[model samples]
Target: MRETSATRRGVLAAAGGALLAGCSGLDEFGESSDEEIRSSRLPDLTDDGESQPVVVETMPIEIERTVLAERVQRTTDLLATLPMSFGADDVPNGYVRKQLIEAAEDASEYIQDARTAQSRLTAMRSLQRARSEARFAAAGWGFVEDGTTETARQSEHEAVIEDANALRSDHAYLGEDPVEAVLFHAEVEQHLAFVAENRYPSGSVNTDELLTVAEWGEHTEYARARVDDGRYLYDRFRESLPADAGSIEETLTTAGESLVDELQRRRSDLPAEPTEGDHELVWRLRYRVRDAAESSARYAGDEPGAASTVLRGAEGLADFLAYERIRDRIDDGEQFGVEEAADVHDARDQAVESVRTALDESPRAGLARPVLADAAQQIVAADEELARLRGTVRPARLDDPIRRYVTATARARSVPAACQEVLDTLTQ
Candidate 1:
């Protein structure tokens, strides 16, 4: 027989009573016993040992509704930010322009459908449809083969596509179907691969080319931003899934591995020599250091461990930047000028101080505190190494010192990698 809400409630209440009795030793004074607990907790079974249906909580549906509403609202806001028209000259291809316009229109319709969806299944379908439209939009933008690329426009298009895919994935996981979750994940990966193929037809940027330092710096910033968004979305989606959603964990782990592989590729492709006029790297480092300091301060009270990780990553990145600055000067055959050395020293000192302050102010509890303290010490050591290298002239062979510094800051670089694992665990 199918259990009604009242029957389910009675069963749960009795199980709770048994638990309380066991925990508080109140069973000694009552009729509660092991057999009673088992009877209450187990489902009624027929002669063939088949259990009856049990009414589950509405929490899963509620989570779906909440997430759908938020996603729809976010999509609406994104739509508003996109330009209504790309002038004839903007794309330089009439067919591409038409495709983009159609994709935008389709996205708007799908989002509307999602907003009005009456069931979880309908909402999931609508969100995925909208995500497809976003992907189409990305492809359309990617087809502009002859125009000057506008970074802001390209970034916005990419953001919309990524956000759409993320929303759809969240909805699928929340639906509690393992197959759907896996399929949705695969769909996202496919779209990402398509975007990559289209955006960089010749593969990744060539390291040996005469690219500006600012260009590479922008790429770093973009990658960091994507990581930040991924972390936040993964946390939210994991929370929405059922406790027993083991498939979600597996999917996320696979995704993390893919991300790690991509990051490794990019890191491996980094140029050994500095690009001409790449002074932007220094400013980027300064900005990242300041951002990390602010984040540490913001998270210090409630999430001291997270704050510590941020500080550690920032410290390592700062050291990396310092090395780059020195390398840039050496590549240019300039003597490590006194003024340039002072600037590098100041940047490193500021970063070190920020991390120290974060560690000092963060609560000294939990396993994270010790790990963070160790990382802080490593940062100090890195700073000392930089000091030793500061006044020295350019060596004939620079790879050795750079490799040494990379090894030294390896822990800091691993912060994001560790975070990816932690994010996957949240599903468990």
Candidate 2:
């Protein structure tokens, strides 16, 4: 019933009065009716909607652009000050520290690029992402640093609470549309609520440190970025709404059908029961595939909110597929101690080989520009993790190594699926 014919009826009309009260002058946008959205025809994806006015909404964050840019640069500089490499003695978790440093560097680049960006909207989005990444690095560093004091952590906890409160208001202005945006909106809302309750979301990455200052700050800032990103995407989708509903509907229908079929295939491929050495992991992945199938099936017929269901299904399907690959290779039962380091090393080597093989099997000698670009990024990430694991893997702490191994393995495994999706999109 949720994915009934009403799904697309008012995809853009769900912005009720309560939600619009906080928005400045955006009330008229929320006042649109289903009939109005349906009747106002616009160019489809292929056509350039140059005739339409550019509706670039204000940046979700209230901070001035220059100030935020400076903060991002400062965070990046702080990260740069740390030694290029850290032993176990230098940091609590070298793998996580390395990732944070890389993330900060990336944020700095984005902030600088936004300065020269021609589009105001694009620049705002880049700035929001940069700021979020910088904050994440700053907060996560507290965990990696050994000498962090309780007083400093308490200060960070208070700052994070403030940040979380600000994000709740900022998120209110984002319109509910495009299944992707809606899903992200819900996640942001949930994360914010968790912050208020001083708890972690279910199945969160930060399971151990539910109330830790560093973890709380990192989680909150990550949610902040999601809110900004979701709003940016919703605005983009609004501008790109096709004048011809039939064309858009047909495309979504075809994609949905493909996703459903893939979901079924993946479900069938999954082990009927949990296997040894990966009992929990296998079942977890199986349930994920099942959940994706259920979600896709909800939007079986092209209905109003079917797009949301389908989009949710696609994301779940990707995770399910990636986890399936992970389950096959991980055997914690066999990995008892430091003596099994060879197995971990071998896993890394195998993951690298799989990525190279995926690239080799690419269509047109991998000349497809989009596929090549995506695969190249995944390859680089895998290589970086591989190198980091090699340098930081100590017998004293296998947790970090295992985490990095899985991260690299999952990225390598997902490359082929990503490639296929790109090819399908191009063909369509």
Candidate 3:
């Protein structure tokens, strides 16, 4: 149950050089248009046998109420200090950050107005890159045969997978909102894969390389702004982190899970021990603490046996996800109290609590939102159910009920804004 400190650190520090290599073009992320990203999620209903229409969520409630009217001013001071941290190199990455800062500077000028809406949407789009693209790649690993030559070869799939290694941030999954937000996210991810699979690079039968990467330049990094430019998306996204109290905690929890998953995915290639990113890796070790707490809390009688059984069953997801800790995260969400989800919630909650203190200290105080813990718990749970269904490898054969169930469940992400407001009032 004890993961060596060295093994743990390996999970946090990714091969940044390889993972971030191609991020350089001045117009890289800017090339892709929003329509392209949104269009991808439109379900290839070409298979009329059983097709689904493009489903987008809509929340008519006012988001301006999420925070205090006066609190808007508080965020301005905070946003001013953010862009400085994104590194001059990655600064000009995109226009997201630039717009966020502009919105922040004009805080008094545009408090709770359309300006906030515009800038926030821009920021959300940047964040979507992680889930819609990076995650699509990482999760696509699910498509490869477990014990094939492809697994050992590190082929084109690796390029596709590695290209999207940034999916774990808060921007990627902003707790459900207007339908456009969810649709854009789902579409971008869909497009990343759709284009990768269909487009062929010039002068190459191999067809695996960046054959159509240029085409995505607009929808992706190409059309994006220079890193140091006022428009740097990444910098702004991080700067304007939610700061809604527990936002930072959630980001750290997510980062921690991401670190572990990232490392675990490639741990086989690491040295016997790891050296950097120890900060991020600690979240994995906390899994044991989570597991033990759960055992004590639940099946205290036959708990050890139950834990062992559950643990063994989840090995595939753990390793594939690159971190055994993901099980802990997945366990906590304990969605619908159904068999698959409830199994992992206990441990995940413990892991979230474990990272509480330090995460609060991070800057983008906004990222410190309470959703950190809950999000980890829920994502872990949803992923578990998805993983359970995946283990069967029966996507093509899903029953009518099953298909609707999974897709509907996935689409049912938007929490009514009114519900959140009610809870916010009670808690505050």
Candidate 4:
């Protein structure tokens, strides 16, 4: 039987509803309460009188390990580059030295925690705490100053102390480790006392303009450093998961599906033929879709994997949808790329291929077999419908363009949920 757009949209919508029902909220990274973690049950493989073969994948461990390694590397790099001594005098005063030592100690403790962390969730939370400590330690050095008179030097010292306190408070997340915060505050107070007694030489005093430049430079550098460190940590965190990590692929796929649904909800607000006036909306949608796909792909762990394939499909679909919108404008005689239709066609093909590949490589064993089979069937049906829509041209009012759009949108949304279903079954 030929698949009409109406029939296709209905099927896709039903599949999406079913997929959404099975998916959980995307709040996995929050700091789990002790009670929650303690109450969480490990997977049980025994059923009836038979022992089912269940394989525990090491992707989670790999993810944890990579995060730890990156944190260690970043903290070590920052410590090495830390300005232990400031001002005209090369040697740091006792107060400055004390703060540096405290920072070093906190960093050391963080390294130990990262190394000893037993789980991925634990490692992530630990890393966040460690980063906060490192930031506070780094901010301490920004207080160092040189001024000509006792009063001027005292004023500068006071300002630095104030800024340090503000910076520390800005990093309240690090307060999760109270000892680290207490030590940081103590160092600040001690440093201020030492500065009161020992002022810089008159010759070494910096002008107001120079001081302003230096202060801004210090703040800018600190912000940039933190950003760089965060990127390094997060990139490694995402890259660490191995392809075989239990149900990670399914988790990622479901996330992608959710993202697509979110996009559809937003797209509904746009006119049938969005114009250049809607450029901001289009760009925002594009970015959201890209972010969603990238986030989902991270769970794929390594390259050339199922999650990666689904990510590719999601991205292709995004591109297709954007181009389709452009094509809609072209139908109104607007100056748009004539090649958009071809681009949409190619993107759809890529999405179909990637989805099929993910389904093919997905594991179908143990307790997850039935669920996986059901998901596979749904994906196959969606894939078939997408294939049928592939050759159709744009702006045909008789074929119901809105229904076709919904069908395509629904299929994209369904992929992730289907992928997640496989993971859910395995974990359960």
Best by TM-score: 2
1-428, model 1: which lDDT tens digit per residue? Answer: 11122222223110000001000111221223422222221111221111111111111222346656655654455445445676787666565466456656766777765565444534444555454454445434433432223454456546645654554345333325432333233333333334333432222443421121212222322332333333334455566666776545444444434433433343444444333354443333333333433443333223112222222332333333334444454456643222223333333333334333433333321211222333334333433344344223332222222222232233233333333333343234
Which whole-number lDDT from 0 to 100 does residue 308 have in model 1? 26
On a 0 to 100 scale, what is the lDDT of residue 238 in model 2? 40
Minimum summed lDDT over a 10-residue window in model 4 is located at: 14-23
Q: Rank by TM-score, highest first.
A: 2, 1, 4, 3
TM-scores, all candidates, are 0.25, 0.34, 0.21, 0.23
Regions more than 4 Å wrong, model 2: 1-126, 129-246, 275-346, 352-411, 414-428
- Report the error of model 1 at residue 54, Å: 24
- Positional deviation of 240 in candidate 2, in angstroms? 9.5
lDDT of 2 by residue, 190-211 (tens): 4455556653422235433312
Q: Write the per-residue lDDT of candidate 3 for residues 68-187, one digit (tens) a residue.
A: 332343334334433343333533434432322333333323343323332343222232231222222221222221322323223443444344333312234332222222222333
Candidate scoring better on TM-score of 2 and 4: 2
Report, for all candidates in order, the number of backbone clashes.
0, 4, 58, 2
Q: Cα lDDT for residue 246, model 3?
A: 27
In model 3, where do residues sit more than 4 Å from their true spots?
1-124, 127-343, 352-382, 385-428
Which tens-of-lDDT digit does each residue in 1-428 have in candidate 4? Answer: 11222342232211111111111112222223322211112111112112211111111113445545666666666556556544446324555445445545665565665565434434443454455445434434433333223344345445644544453333221222221222222222333333333333222233443333333333333333333333343344334434443324344435435545544554444344323344343333333333443443343333222333333333333333434444454456543211223322333333333333433444322212222222323433433333444332332211222222323333343444443443343234
Q: Residue 65 error for model 1, in Å?
A: 3.9
* lDDT accuracy of residue 307 in candidate 3: 17
Q: Which pairs clash in model 2?
A: 7-304, 7-305, 8-304, 42-243
